[model samples]
Target chain A: MAVDKNLPILIVDDYKTMLRIVRNLLKQVGFDNVEEAMDGSSALTKLRESRFGLIISDWNMEPMTGLQLLREVRADAKLAAIPFIMITAESKTENVIAAKEAGVSNYIVKPFNAETLKSKLQSVLGAF
Target chain B: MTPSNVLAEQKLLRQRIDAAHAEAAQPLSREEVGDIVREVLTTMQGDLSAQDLGLYKELESLARYIQHARREIAAIRPADIRDCHLPTAHDELDAVVGATETATFAIFDACDAIGVIAGGIDGEQGVKLTEQITRIFEACNFQDITGQRITKVVKALKHIEAKVDALVAAFGESALGALEADPEPAGDAALLHGPQLPGNAINQDEIDRLLASFD
Candidate 1:
């Protein structure tokens, strides 16, 4: 499947450096319309304010965690259907199960290289 | 007075003085001596008169002096220990600052890579740019690795703090003992300066190779 290059995407991570890295990586893989959030709450605010085709989020964060954000997204009628992917350092089986239960489209563990990110994104977007 | 009686009186006086000195060396608190004085007076069968008063007065004065000396000794120990700890705390702070500086440089390199990739350069130039971007990611990875090292360093520093606290507490408890013991103040500062672990020390060439994998 071919990913829409123009689709607005939101990337969430507490680290500004990681956000920039993911944003740049996504841009390299032909997704130019990408935005960023430093945490889940900010991401939610951005989601409510604007439309995004995909949500890629980091799991560990202060205040509202990624899982909480994922549940919130799925519970909302307007935001429920937006494709959500989780990117995190927590690679435990239990954590993966919890994310799957909470309705994650895909999961990627760090420190992932460019190709791994591409394939994961393609797998979820069905564009690989 | 008879010569034999005079000699007995002198010997008794000398014994009283010796007991006073011994009591002075032990350094009992004020409340402890009150009960001991009561016990001694009761045991003396009401014969405690002015003739025996001098020795008791002398013992009390000596005990007071020992207590004062103990306090002075206690007060000086931590000041001495802290004199050594200050420099070590400063050194650890410097190490943390250095780590932060290295992390900042890594952030700059990552930003530069993103800029190059955004410029839309292609061909061998693009490949080099991608190579540079990979280097940026490698730097990012180092950032995480260095972060872990910093956490370990912080934990070690915390352990140092705990050790210093324990030492200070022990010094406080033995203030009186230390006064009598008169220990030579050794330079224990060296003990606090433990083996330094390398933090944020990255091989530039290795990072370059990791980045090359993207090509």
Candidate 2:
């Protein structure tokens, strides 16, 4: 399937560094139209306000986590179908299981390069 | 009789009577003595420590608390054997900062290298180089996030230092001030473990094996 590169993707992480890194990786993968949120709460607000093709978020964040965000997105009728990917520093099996139960589309571990990110995006949004 | 002789003889007689009265005074009952001791100990709760048995009891309790705190500290040192502590909280925190520092430095170094390489590029190639540079600039945001995290750690350490200083001030540095053995580093919080160091954390294959076991 052909995925639009201009879909206005949402990238979320509590750490600005990780956010920038992911965003750049997204650019390298052909998606230049993107937006970033610092944490799950802000990401929720952004999701409600804008239509996004994909969401790449970190698992560990204050106030609300990526898993929480995934659950919230799945719960919301307006945002339910948007593809969601979780990026985590934690590779604990329990966390992966939880994210899967919450309807996460894909999972990526931290310290990932652009190539790893590309495959994750491709799995969720189709051929990039 | 002479006035001087009268005074001296009278003083001697008074002294004798006083000595006799003191000797004749009744001994205190154990219950009454207990009450006095309780009162004294109550007054010295946080202020003064005495040499009596009651004070010794209080010291015994306080020593238990100190020992508990010392044990906790010991458990944090990966090198300490008392507790089967591995990768203690201190080590985890240090690893976080160290890893972040190294990664951040690498990012900056890469950007510098790119700049040096970009200098030799001609006009047509400059456009692509500019895009790469822009990406590098965007990636520098890690500094702000890392700074916030490190600041949080420093604040916690400062708070601990203040409490320890107060404890030292309350108890003399010699008996109470003697530093206890360090704690061994061990896993405490299972879920909240951040980026694990190379040897410390299991890789994807291990995680997959764990997952497959359940299946």
Q: Quick one: best TM-score, which candidate?
A: 1
The true-versus-predicted C-alpha distance at residue B83 of model 1, in Å, is: 16
Each prediction's whole-model lDDT (CA): 0.74, 0.72
Question: DockQ of each candidate's interface versus the true one?
Answer: 0.11, 0.07
Q: What is the DockQ of candidate 2?
A: 0.07
lDDT of 1 by residue, B56-148 (tens): 777677767766765765655554444455556656666765666577567767667676664687568767767666556635644443444
For model 1 chain B, where is the 10-residue window of minimal lDDT?
A: B173-182
Which regions of candidate 2 are displaced past 4 Å? B1-215
RMSD of every prediction: 16.6, 19.5
Clashes of 2: 18
Give the Å shift of residue A89 in candidate 1: 0.9
Residue A120 Cα positional deviation in candidate 1, in Å, after optimal superposition: 0.9
